[model samples]
Target: MGLGKLLHDHAEHADVGGTIDHPRAYELAAEIGFLGRRREIFTRLAALSGVRPGDRVLDVGCGTGYLTRILAPIVSPAGRVTGVDASAPMVEHARRRAPGNCSYQVGEGQALDLPDAGFDVVVSSLAVHHIPAAERGAALREMFRVLRPGGRLLIAEFRPPTNHLLAQLVGMVSGPAMRHSPHDLLGDLIPAAGFHVQDEGDLPVMLSYVRALRPST
Candidate 1:
């Protein structure tokens, strides 16, 4: 795969925008040492998501289904978990790795093929930033639309370093597509999407976790 694939050129294609193929995606994961922390990160995201038994959950931008696998058993027996990503290769790999309760789809954050108010909890980790910064708000609204009344929304994003040097280093390693600056934007976008911001703080390492909820009607 080319560098553009890993960087995710959002302009070339409108709907399914990401370009990270299986090899490059996994290679990046290994390069960042994210593979080791994958389980821990997924656990934190799932806990913050407040996923309960029998709840329907959606994992947006569920690259390789690492988080989706962690979520399946939590909402098992009667619950269902669906993982979606813009990269077909990622989706394919995730499907191969998925459990009985989990499924994968090729989709984008800004426009999901799911129905309105269908999920009890919607979560994405280190994924939303792949969407173009200009269209992030729309993607947040899309997350909101799929969530049922009183459903939870949890997103795990990079906690940008306060130090300029470290920040630039992080940007360089994570790529230009990571310029969405989740910490700065999600605080506002979640509420604007009609979700009530419930909790926000650091997860482990460089990640920041935000938990929100759709108001019950």
Candidate 2:
């Protein structure tokens, strides 16, 4: 079995790409996948999010709440960070590790059970490709729906290495879901969903990100 299959629970949500049920194992894999720089890379992601103190933030597909933990301090005391994932086990694991200002729930990204325009910022990482390919558009729309007008969004996804051999190796280990170039994976979804894309670029350790905002008007 590929490492992706090993870490995922295919039997649970067969319609969805794959739901990772083993939080501890997923955590270890993420650490190894990032080559011990998960924190550093995620910190940059948080910065790119343009989150401020007292800003209400939402994390979609927040596996194990790793990014939420990094964001907790920044939005602490007054602001809050809410994490949503499809897997109950993953949500439970994140709840255990959640800080006082952070909370978690079991929910789908394509059909979020959140109020419209409720969040100041919304971020999703390595989560879009996990949604069924047909539903990715809905998921991006949902992200736009939940964020207040003028709210910021940051989406980070795995960028396959440029080297052919390394890219094939990544595919073998992680499965086909991660093999897509971020541009192809995202396409015009952000703009189609009503987001004004601000910037996008590659990050170290094979990551790519797009920053966008909901128009205030």
Candidate 3:
């Protein structure tokens, strides 16, 4: 089976909980209200993204289309939101739930099929971490290539824990995820990808939202 198919199997009933056909994300993030913390994070991204009504947006690892659907309205009528994930089941769920303004496809994060500089904004929430540690920097590079000058890339990833309690808890719940933690300097890696890292910080405190912007000339 291809990687996509393998991913599909692992994701069976893996998503949060709602869609009977599609698996739920372990985060159970969609359970939150549309105007809740997610909205707040995206609002900040919108401002930093320079995502006007007519700019194209790319959603990397857009599971179940939560953030993708949210971005559609903001960039609608003129702009479009494209969601890409490797899991067929996840893509199906996203397609069913997504409005016509959005499109979902089964694809890999490191090797996006989209053309260069095609998007004005590139965003991923709690998704980039799934990529293998060695290729995450390449994934960011791909995002950079697809983003137009001044396009924005916002990623919310799990940061290294400060205490053993949080670490232990993370190990228990997301231990498998630990393999993807490369310990790379995300602050500097964003810049190394050809885009200056405009902002680097933890967001929502508990969620560890890491955000960066690439300015266009």
Cα TM-score per model: 0.85, 0.95, 0.75
**Please, what are the lDDT tens digits per residue for candidate 3 over residues 95-189?**
88988889989887789998999988898766765665466678889999999887788776656566767666554444333323323424455
Model 1, range 1-217, lDDT digits (tens) per residue? 4444445544344223355565455656544645377577668778888999999999988888888889899998699999989889888888888899998899889999999999999998877666766777899999999998998999887766677886776655555534545656464888888999997888665778888999997
Judge candidate 3 at residue 64 and give its lDDT: 79
Stretches of candidate 2 off by over 4 Å are 9-16
Worst 10 residues of 3 by lDDT: 12-21
lDDT score of model 3?
0.65
All candidates: CA RMSD in angstroms? 3.2, 2.0, 6.2
Q: List the residue pairs that clash in candidate 3.
A: 14-24, 15-23, 15-24, 15-25, 16-24, 16-25, 149-216, 150-215, 150-216
Predicted candidate 2 versus true structure: per-residue lDDT over 136-199, tens digit per residue: 9999999999999999999998898989998877665566556678888889999999999999
**Which should have the higher lDDT, number 1 or number 3?**
1
Would you list the clashing residue pairs of candidate 1? Answer: none
Q: Rate the local accuracy (lDDT) of all candidates.
A: 0.78, 0.89, 0.65
Clash totals, every prediction? 0, 0, 9
TM-score top scorer: 2
True-structure lDDT of candidate 1: 0.78
TM-score of 3: 0.75
